[model samples]
Target chain A: MNRTRFLDSSRLTSALFWLSLVGIVTGLYAAFIYAPNEKTMGVVYRIFYFHVPSAWVAFLSFLVVFVGGIMYLRTRERRWDTLALSSAEIGVVFCAIALITGSIWGKPAWGTWWTWEPRLTTTLVLWLIYAAYLMLRRMIEEESQRARVAAVFGIVGFVDVPIVFMSIRWWRTVHPIVFTIDEIRIAPSMLAALLIALVAFTLFYLYLLIQRISLENVGHELEALKQRVA
Target chain B: MDGVKKALWIVWKDVVCELRTKETLSSMFVFALLAIVIFNFAFQLRGDERVGLIAPGVLWVAFTFAGVLGLNRSFIKEKDHGCLEGLMLCPVDRSAIYAGKALGNLAFMLLMEAIALPMFAVFFNLPVLMPSLLLVILLGTVGFAGVGTLFSAISVNTKAREVMLPILFFPVLIPIVIAAVKSTAQIFDGVSFDQSMPWINLMLAFDVIFLVVSFLSFEYVVEG
Candidate 1:
């Protein structure tokens, strides 16, 4: 009975699937048409369409990990642990896109592929910390122990993101804090484009998160089935 | 009254055990001294260039690396003899255990810092023994030991205990380290306390926030 419940997909999940399709199409359309060419760096600024949203979604996924971690530790529920792991795995995917897209954007803008500027360096460190969080989980063998340890780490690791982001502002750094709504003046079209992209990316992220959770639930059901057969 | 007494007993027991063995302290001291020696040899501190610039970085690096050793050992001794489980089995409140361990770790770290500060003055010909700089060290140590105690508990249970502590620790500690280094540098430059107050405030805030979070979350990490 529990196994069947686990395998069953919900209506919310299907809704997210359609939402994600809308998001991807609107996101690309806005990026290519609505957003204006950059005055300083033409053509390449289009990368911001994908790059910024990927990072935003990556950060959102980690926040899920943090909340899920706290819930797991509080309730000692295996489902929360599964949610935390699924979110972390998807978060890594977005983080990878953020890193790669940022690098690709960097090549044209900064005239160099990489510099140990504060923002870039801290983002790299953020990547390493979560990578280590996943590695820590893999190294532990016992299921309960893995969940416990990983939950603790997930909480600790997510708390560091704000610190990493602020390090550039606290310590003097060369990375320009662009796109501050207060600081930079932008045309209406550009703002509209960004808003559309933000909405689309958010939908896409929700879609991915739901899909991953569904797949994880299926895996858990399969394991239970095998256990029953045994 | 009984719970308070029991907590004090735990704290005192840790202190006396350290006094007798002196293992954690001795290794931390020696490790700190060696770190300074390595920095001196590597950087080749010339005449006036030494005093202001090197003092803050050297003290922090020494404290950070030495703190790692001290933090790892903080739990190893408890786990070795199964005392941690015994403590958990006690009726005393769990937060008391965290407070006791944090205080004990703080004392050990301060002792090492106390010794290292004077030695740093002698070795580098810097005036790090100043009262203001000492205040920065005190504030910095509070933040370090607060978070270190928590991460140590979490890391000690992991597979790669030693490596896991730093990887988990250093990122969360960046703010504290930055504040410590900045405040120390300000003091070294003879800046007034007002100039360095913001960094001090940041350190205090971090210490309070993490201290509370760690205290609340510690039970989860230790539960078998």
Candidate 2:
């Protein structure tokens, strides 16, 4: 809570920016050069390079919601709310990318742009649920009220994500769950590329999260400034 | 002695006021009836094939929308007259206030469903008045009210409260709706209780989870 500690946190932002640059470069190289063309879908399957990683990060965002929400409710600190909001926003972005890239990948693989198969449908539902969370935050004027209610929602909303994910496995669905890691069917080079992509995307997510937290801090400061001026 | 009596007194005051005015009940009943009518026209519920598959969805949809109306009114009256703040100032447990409000909202919703169910059966020419189906309706209503009351308290404080309640309520209530509709359909198909137990269990789970969650979170929501 010290002012110096708070100000020094900005250094982490620069570190993330540099790390993300390296990740993007490595991800692009692996996707285009290193990974082999998938036999069934051909070139378009390469979209998994970005698509799968984005999906992983989206789920990670909700994990932040769980931890940050619990802390906010327990400590009654505004910082935790800021962290939750940042994570939710980043989660939404990654979810959007996942949907779009999945669609792009689907066109060649599934021969259609869209289908209500469990994977796609559940992802769509996850998107709307978090979007509703952000909307609920906007609908409340008081910061404390917004934080408390949204934290409660963040916790409850996260419980649904796993259910949504499992709905595909539980019920019959058309979307195929390809690339089971344990199956070991994919080529070694392709697997290597995917590992690199995963690392890169995770670093990218960290970078985005830091940027968002900084922006939120600035917005909070601006609000405080306005209050003082008023 | 006085605190318990005062809280009970507030509960009675709300019930009597609602009885005399009947604003919540009438609005919810008429809204539910209209929703059923709209569904009837929209789906053309004449044939047996269409009616069987769509009946459960139509019934629950009506319940959800009508329940939203009831939830919105439950707090608006208290907030309008500043009775909520007065209630908060009392020495009684805040959970009592949540319980009383939720129970009142549950009563209004059940009343609306009671009217809607018979009308739905008559309109669709479906026999939904069976005991098993009625039991499913009652259990589903508990899950709905348990969560709806908590979210209503939260949403009523928001800027666009009327719109906010459904958005917040629906996603969290998805499990309930799915379980309710599945079980109702199973009963309508003449399935035995053993066949329907899983969905029933799921509904019970949802009710317990939300009831506990809402009870614990109610204080944070109602706090100034």
Candidate 3:
């Protein structure tokens, strides 16, 4: 019965995965073909579809990690630790995508590959902070000790992220205005395309999170079985 | 209240140990001094002409790197003598150990900063000994040490203790460093205190947030 239930869930996941694949293809088509080009940035502006959605999903992933951290601390459940670790790893990847896409968009838009603009700067710092989180997890050998310490870190690190954003925002204001994304008005079709991309990327993040968590569980079981045989 | 007093005792214990050994303080001070010297040569600044430009960056970089050295010692010393487990065994609130260690780390960082200030002034040929600059230094160090102490405890149990401290330290320290560097640069530029109030306020916010969060979370890090 348990095996049958597990297979049922696996079937659901596979169906959801296929649904997301379809959503992503549609999102791409809408982004590239449906959305009209801007007068200023031209065709290259299509990267915004990928850029903004990736950043949104990345932030969402970190939020999950933060909640998982708190849950782990409160309940001492190993499952929460698995969720936090997996989400953080995925978060780092999406954050890197946000950064790379932002840089690519910046190159033609601002004529520089990188700028110390507030959002980009904060995102880069966010990337570094979570990267450090993963590295900290790697350094600890004991399972429970690693979970507890990493939880504390995730909680404290999340609190600091807002302060970091604010400070960088203020710092940027004191300097000259390099370029402003605010000036670009989102046309209706562009907004539609952005919404499609957001939905698709969010589904993609959920799919990845589910897959990673199950893989971790399998790995945990394998470790246990190996120890039992030994 | 008992927790507060116990925490104070933790601070006193560290102070006495540090005074007798002076090892951590001396190393931190020397390391910071060397960094300042390196900065002086690295920038190749002539006189006070470029001192304002480079002084803040140089000062903060020195302080943070040196601050990590002191923070690492805060917990490692306890771990070395097995005092850490003993402290945990005590009936007192676990956070007292955190408070004590953070306060101790804060004091060492401030002392290093105090001594380094004169050297910084001497090397850059700038009068950076103002009361305002000291305020910025204190706020920045408190935030840095507050978070650093917690992470140091967490890092000490890790394999790569030395590398782990800075890796964990620098990223979370971005706000404090930014606020400190910006305000310190303004002070060196001879900007009045009021001009740097915004940055100072930001530092104050960072300090309070990290202090509360670290104090609350320290138990988990240390107990684990």
Fnat for each model: 0.47, 0.47, 0.89
TM-scores of all predicted structures: 0.89, 0.91, 0.97
In model 3 chain A, the worst 10-residue window by lDDT is A1-10
Off by over 4 Å in 1: A1-15, A112-122, A173-185, A225-230
| Model 1 lDDT at residue A153 | 78
The order by descending lDDT is 3, 2, 1
**Could you give candidate 2's per-residue lDDT for residues A10-90 as a string of tens digits?**
677778778888888988998998788877667877888888888888889978977888889998878888889988999
Q: Where does model 2 exceed 4 Å of error? A: A1-8, A164-185, B1-11
lDDT for A185 (candidate 1): 44
Say which candidate scores most in TM-score.
Answer: 3
Expressed between 0 and 1, the share of native interface contacts present in candidate 3 is 0.89
Query: Over 4 Å off in model 3, which ranges?
Result: A1-8
Better of 2 and 3 by TM-score: 3
Q: Point to the candidate with the largest lDDT.
A: 3
Write down the lDDT of every candidate, Cα atoms only: 0.80, 0.81, 0.88
Which docking category, incorrect, acceptable, medium or high, applies to candidate 1?
acceptable
Report the number of the highest-DockQ candidate. 3
- lDDT agreement of model 2 with the native: 0.81
* TM-score, chain A, candidate 1: 0.88
Candidate 3: tens digits of C-alpha lDDT, residues A1-230: 23211222677678779988988999999999999999778899999999999899888988888998998999887888988998999999999999999999999998999999989998998899899999999999999999999998888878888998999998988888687777777899999999999998988887888788888888888899999999
Q: Residue B107 deviation, candidate 3, in Å?
A: 0.9
